[model samples]
Target: MNQPDHEFPDESRTIRPHAGESIEDTRNWPGLALVAVGLVLLALTLTAAGYGFAGWAVIAGALCGVCLLGGIGIVVAEHRRVKAR
Candidate 1:
């Protein structure tokens, strides 16, 4: 069988950077933390609703909103930073 066109080759390759080439930093801890908090709050919200605890669910849902907004804010700030560069 032929491999799909979208598949990358399995051959090993070596990459060499030219002079003055610097590796870029690719860490996004704040956004990752916000996303993780949002996911945990999502689970809490679901569990609370399943247990018929409307109050807990509401609180968790509100926290979920905050986490989501924080994630969005991080993304927007990062985008602006990259655009400015």
Candidate 2:
């Protein structure tokens, strides 16, 4: 008997993980920690302004911006690094 025609090839056979791909998706813990802190700082910034601590609100906002940008930079860098190989 002939085998039945399939709709598509098995996808897993054609796909492979990048060499740099982490099973745990955990690179440096510090980067994840910074992202977490940035989120908290952003929340705190809004709270600080609401509580009338204008100066602290400004400082926290700036720090939050820095952390957000840095985390984004790290992600871009990792993507580039993996794709290059």
Candidate 1: what lDDT? 0.71
Residue 13 displacement (Å), model 2: 9.2
Clashing pairs in 2: none
Output the lDDT of residue 20, model 2: 44
TM-score of 2: 0.66
Q: Taking the tens digit of each residue's C-alpha lDDT, what string does model 1 give over 1-85?
A: 9975552322124243333222132434576678789999999999999999999999999999899889768755765564455
True-vs-predicted CA distance for residue 15, candidate 2, Å: 9.3
lDDT of 2 by residue, 1-85 (tens): 9996664433334454455453235653456677778999999999999999999999999999999878767765665564464
lDDT of each: 0.71, 0.73
